[model samples]
Target: MNYAHLKEELIEYSKTIGIDKLGITTADPFLSLKDRLIAQQENNFASGFEHSNIDERVDPRLSVQQARTIISIAVAYPSKLKNPPKSLPGKRRGFFSRSSWGVDYHDVLNERLKKLEAFLEARCGPEAMMRMVDTGALSDRAVAERAGVGWSAKNTFIITEEFGSYVFLGNLITTIPFPVDKPLEDLCGSCTKCIDACPTGAIVEPGVLNAQVCLSYQTQTKGFMADEFRSKIGNHLYGWDTCQLVCPYNKKIPQPAHKEMEPDPEKVKPLLLPLLSLSNKEFKREFGHMAGSWRGKKPIQRNAIIALAHYKDQTALPKLVELMHDDPRPVIRGTAAWAIGKIGDSKKEENELLIAKKREEDQEVLEEIDKGLTLLGFAVEK
Candidate 1:
């Protein structure tokens, strides 16, 4: 079997199917990645969302028996919103990071991977290939870096020259011995833009991220947001982009041509108030298709409350009061209480918080109510 000729055919086929970039690499164990991941775990930098087994994450053979090569593909997503709606005083909106702007990349990229898998299976028999998008045990970035899809940048994103860091990466592990492509050179020399721009200083050092403090990771968390990050999150409801927005490599990149990745401004930057009252079914119907909806309504609603406080939108007070008094979830109720204080109309907000405090059963919610009263210049008993 002519592996070189097959690789050429795959590249051409990829172009026809909307894969923006493709590269191949031998499936040797990722020795360097294994060490870095161990360090990340030791330093408590891991987001805990990653696959826990280090061996499976770095070694392709463990994921796919007899894996000989990895084929990495990138799909570019748009950075700029087309005709974005204005976020005016009463009609404030919360931003979803660019990556969550359109249809979830997981679905879009997986469909492309399925097509590639079918093509490979037809040529090399049923047992030839296995494919993965971001969710799989194998590190998508590591595979992409080794396969020459892009260089892993200081912000920890795979930076493709054509798409900057705004590309979705995925891979196919195959038994076919395809010729390997060389990795890209490190291009982020002496650039501290991403590190400097990180709101929480989550980028602890060049090429290293303390995910626990990352606004993007924090936005996805289901629990009460730490107070330090509350103000820094601003109007971002799902994920944050300060690091990516400041990266020099991402500047002046052409808008992606892929229609699936184009941002629907209203969906990605929806009004914060409406989100607080969304029923579970309503949340699913409106946002389930977007990548940001993975953590469900609680975190988004909590962030939305924080965003309203960020705007200090007096219009949101009535709704915020209702959430503080009646919301079932303690995180939502507690966050709303904090927001009410932050967006203070001291007399009315303090009175409402005091009333809620008397009836609130959750200790965390009670603490937030007291904090709210205190923020409004009313003293609370210690």
Candidate 2:
């Protein structure tokens, strides 16, 4: 088989199908990434969302028996919103990271991969290929780095010279032996923009992220946000991109070729107050297509409450007070209490908080109530 000709044909076909970048590498074990993953685990820096087994993540052969060549593809996403809605007072807005904008890339990339898989199956056999996106057992970044799709930047993103860092990566492991592409040279010689710009200093070192401290990771968490991050999350309802926004590569990238990724200003920067009351169906209808809704409504609502608090929007006091008094979820109720206190129309909301405090049974909720009261300069009777 003339695999070199096949590789060229595949690259040409990829451009026709909207794949912004494509590269190939031998499907050998990712020796260096294995070490890094182990170190991330040992240092408690992993996001806990990754596939826990190190071997499964580093070896393509484990995922696809007799794997020979790995095909890596990138689809560029838009970095700028076309016409963003204003975040005026009494109508505060929350930001979803650029990654979550437009249709979820998972579906878009999977469709492209499926087409590529079909092309390969026609040439080889149907049994010759396996593919994966972000949720796959193999590391997408490792595959992209090895395949020369991009250099692994200090911000931990694949920085393609063409697409910069705003690219969605996926890979296909096939038994066909194609010549491998060499990895790109790292262009980030002395720049520390992403590290210096991280709001929580999650990038403990270049290319090393402590996900626990990452504002992006914190936004997706379901529990009550730690006190320290509550004020820092600002109006970000889902995911944070301070690190990526600061990268020089991301800043200079051309407009995205994929219209599917263009941000609907209303959805990515939705009004924060309306999110607090979204029914399951409403939340699904509004944000289900976006990547950030994967954790469901509670985390989004929890982060919405935090965004409200971050703004200290006094006009939201009534709704926040209602949540503190009537919401069934302890996290929402407690966070509302905290926000109400933080906003501090002391005479108006302090009585309501005291009353809620007396009846609240959850120990965590009680602690939040006490914190709220303390923030409001009220002496605790108990």
Candidate 3:
């Protein structure tokens, strides 16, 4: 394989496939990623499926025979329509973080990588094999930084001067020996916009995040969650985007050019009442093709209930009452109770007090019921 021309062809092919940026790097830079794997698991900040063995993920021995090079690529999915609707009365809005508001990127990236790998084999002979995308546990952001695609920001996101941190990353690991590139230095000097803007304080310190406290993670989990986190989750249904919205780099970049990536008008501003009544089947049909559908209907519905509670929208009272009594998940039931308290009047409050009296075992739900009763001029039956 002629290394020089192979490198040039790879860059040209990536651009042809519509990738925003591409880079070549040696696999050796990932040696340090194994060291932090344990601490990440212990802190519970790592994704549930994140490989615990750092060596297994980054080691070429596990991924490919005689692996020598990695081809890193980035795809930008910037939002063309900005200004998410405000939290005002009678305004229906559902904010899916830019990442989740389109067809899943993983599938798109994998197809592109496979095509590139096939081209390599056709040119470089049959000795090369490819492991594409985020597989093999390689540190993609680290690789992209080293390859000169972008710099790693203090927000723990890769910030490209041209595309910002909105680019989706994927990689091709192969046995071909390509020339490696140098990494850029971190350029997020003293910028704390992301850290300070986090509503749940999930970004505890510079470049560190606790996924448990993140609204993104909370919307993907089931069961009763912390009350404190609930109040701050705001109107986000799938993920949080406050940090990216405040970033200067993102502001300077042009909006997405792809029309298919635009938020669906029907989905862009989902009504809370309709979302609350979604059966599992309906939810799967509606959002099954999207990324946020992985956790099913429960979390999305729960998030909508939280937004209603935060807004104190009385129009949602009937829906909240129905959910309070009928929701199979206790966490959803508890959240419904909280929303009802914020919206219901004295008569409806007394109805909820009776319901609470029948099943007061769940301390969380009972607490919400008590607050509702108090707000509606009811006395505690002490």
For all predictions, the C-alpha RMSD in Å is: 0.9, 1.1, 2.7
Pairs in clash, predicted candidate 3: none
Q: What clash pairs does model 2 have? A: none
Better model by lDDT: candidate 1 vs candidate 3: 1
In model 1, state the lDDT of residue 64.
85
Better of 1 and 3 by TM-score: 1
lDDT (10s digit) by residue, model 1, range 1-382:
9989999999999998889999999889999999999999999999999998999998899988898999999999998887889899999999999989789999999999999999888898876677788889899999999888999888999999988998999998988889989999989989989998887889898889999999999999999999999979899999988888888888999887887888888999999889988999999999999999999999999999999999999999999998888888999999999988988866988999989988989999998898888889898999
Clashes of 1: 0
Model 1 TM-score (2 dp):
0.98
In model 2, the runs with Cα more than 4 Å from the true position are none
lDDT of 2 by residue, 25-128 (tens): 99899999889999999999999999878998999899898899899999999888888999989999989999999899999999999999998888877657
- Top-down lDDT ranking: 1, 2, 3
Clash count of each predicted structure: 0, 0, 0
TM-score (all chains, Cα) for each model: 0.98, 0.98, 0.89
Models ranked on TM-score: 1, 2, 3
